[model samples]
Target: MDGERLFCDIALAARIERAEARLIAESSGAARARRGDSVGFARPFAGGVASFAEADSPFDKVAGLGFAGVPDAAELDEIERAFAELGAPVQIELCQLADAAVGAFLTGRGYRLESYENVLGRRVGDATFPDGVRYCRDDELETWLAEVADAFAVADTEGLPSHEEFPRGTVIDAMRDMAGVLRFVAERDGDFAGGASFRVTDGIAQFTGAATVPVHRRRGVQTALLRARLAVAAEAGCDIAVVTTQPGSKSQQNVQRQGFDLLYARAILVKGTSAISSSGADSRQAS
Candidate 1:
């Protein structure tokens, strides 16, 4: 990764936010219809997308909001109403670089701060593909998904605990909902040890999420997976790769060690009766 084209600016934030919003939309659109599923959907409002993957699903929230501009009272009211109709709180992952007026608007509407997450980025120039890590084959998609879901089910103790704990099936279903993502698998002694994924949109590669199983933690599995993905991202013509991590967590440290910089942070703010623990954060498990 090089510094020439890498920067932390509103222009860069726009690219990242737009990619994330599109991914959420794709996930919501691909939501499966099952007997008891809550019927997920994504609504584009103001400058971003408000999505619901199911009640309490980590995927249920507003992402990339207010990037285009601050919303009017009517837009905010409709966003709240959409979540209210589903009996879920309105959660917004508001970027720090978003229009300042939007933050005041949210505060006036009684949205309280829940947690914060950091977005790290690096130029995708070149990387050596780590041994034992490779792109997930089509036939191994389910196995890769299962491995990642299982790892994420157990929150990393080195970081602030996750605000939510989803069922194993819910995690898998949520992952399945993401469209056009490239998956990777890391093996140790020929056994599945970890999994990771990234989605490229207009040269920005967003590392969706990654996890190493309990037995594989601290074995460099995630690092290998990360390097493998970075290598692939470069080959795919991506100029930058970004990942979100809980502030001060091991995941954040790991990425920083790989030359990623703290690009920006998103304050997780919410309105309604959802119980957000003071000691928990709203970030994907990436260790």
Candidate 2:
């Protein structure tokens, strides 16, 4: 409210969650086209999107829920049926600001709380891309993907550890095919040291993910990447920038240092565990 700072309200949650739903849906559509199959599906349910990128890929979950109120019995049934058909779990990232009825319905149907991810935001203002950070060229896409995937594979011991894991190649493909994504790269001594990305929607700059390679850790690579994306987002006229991060993790700490405040947190709930916990339910794949 004051100074144009964002408030953690239903309106803000709806905007961020809906934008994320559309982005994931588009990314899944792109993945399906690439593989020429029905592996990726985005189903609209409860005013949100229930998407499946693959059995184990991270883009598989229901997002943007509760914005339109709690789902009815039939709507819930449809969502369950859709994921069941794909032999995947019904994973939902329920915003804490969502209607209490929504969480009641989910847990009543056997959805267990698996994890939580904090959503941080900041009003867009002045930002400058630090030296050695720039947009990733088309020719350097593969290298950027490799670095990001590798960084994710090396699990950080702090915060909550991911409940699921995917092959490195799967991670790469997910990042590569994410629709409307803008990629950025950070360098150290003229070598690729880290990468980051963002997507703008309705004046909200969504910082999707960022990571530094193992060899370049603690060298301010992620900080540079974050600044570069913020500058780019401001140039694009975004009013706000947001990122999701594992609670208490280094990523969360890093963004906080950059002036991002905790806008809200998403309670990750799941209904099935027959397969690996639907990967990427956290939204922040690397960061």
Candidate 3:
């Protein structure tokens, strides 16, 4: 397939995964809204009108204010108004397929291209992982969550929700409700060390929430988890596997080391004068 078409497919699949996460959040009684490709969710739930734990996984965000083929300046104005209504400075991530008109409208209204992420993709193949990686059992979710929370805290301690959210009051409770998504964790000396999540839809699988505790960094914990998830995706008949990471990040290096190719760089655009104001409080990259 062509580059633009492939990127769109990846984007759509990512959005579908995101929408599913939001729907699950709403089903779990969290407040959220969906409009085409755009979804708005409430705070502390992981998926909401105000996202607290932003990741590279497609569904890791809370809302999309402008990247819905919405080339109309008038509608763009309405979107800004909606952002104001929500009372959170939501970001809109878009690929190269986005029309110049959309970019122009967002820019004219004070939107800034603050950062970009690389969306990498590759066809399914053999799934080989290092020893010690294993799937998370239903009964072991709490342990897994705690370990992940610890790992994430090490990555960005301030961005995570208080221990009172869900699945110990973190949004992971809603994630556990998602279909076709599986969790894998690594163990060292029989203690949870690192882990990752896989979300499969329309023959595409995405690796998400990969984390390794501070004590486990650079010790092949994530590499093993990644291969395990890819193998699972391939065994399930997936045609493509995708992962997103910040440009020049160590996580990006990990995926590339696993043979994932550079698909496209998705731009994370922020609107309003408060653009990036939430970075210190909400910015945390995925593994």
Which candidate has the highest lDDT of all? 2
lDDT of 1 by residue, 9-67 (tens): 99889889988888887777677443356475788877788888776667788898767
Give me the overall lDDT of model 3.
0.56
Q: On a 0 to 100 scale, what is the lDDT of residue 143 in model 2?
A: 81
What clash pairs does model 2 have?
58-279, 58-280
Candidate that scores best on TM-score: 2
Q: lDDT tens string, model 3, 172-275?
A: 44344334568888888887778777877567776655778778777777778878877898788887777766567667678778777777665667765332
Give the clash count for model 3: 10
Question: Global lDDT of each model?
Answer: 0.80, 0.82, 0.56
Candidate 1 segments whose C-alpha is farther than 4 A from its true place: 1-5, 32-38, 277-283
Candidate 2 Cα misplacement greater than 4 A, ranges? 1-5, 274-287
Model 3 stretches astray by more than 4 angstroms:
1-70, 156-180, 273-287
Cα deviation of 253, candidate 1, in Å: 0.6
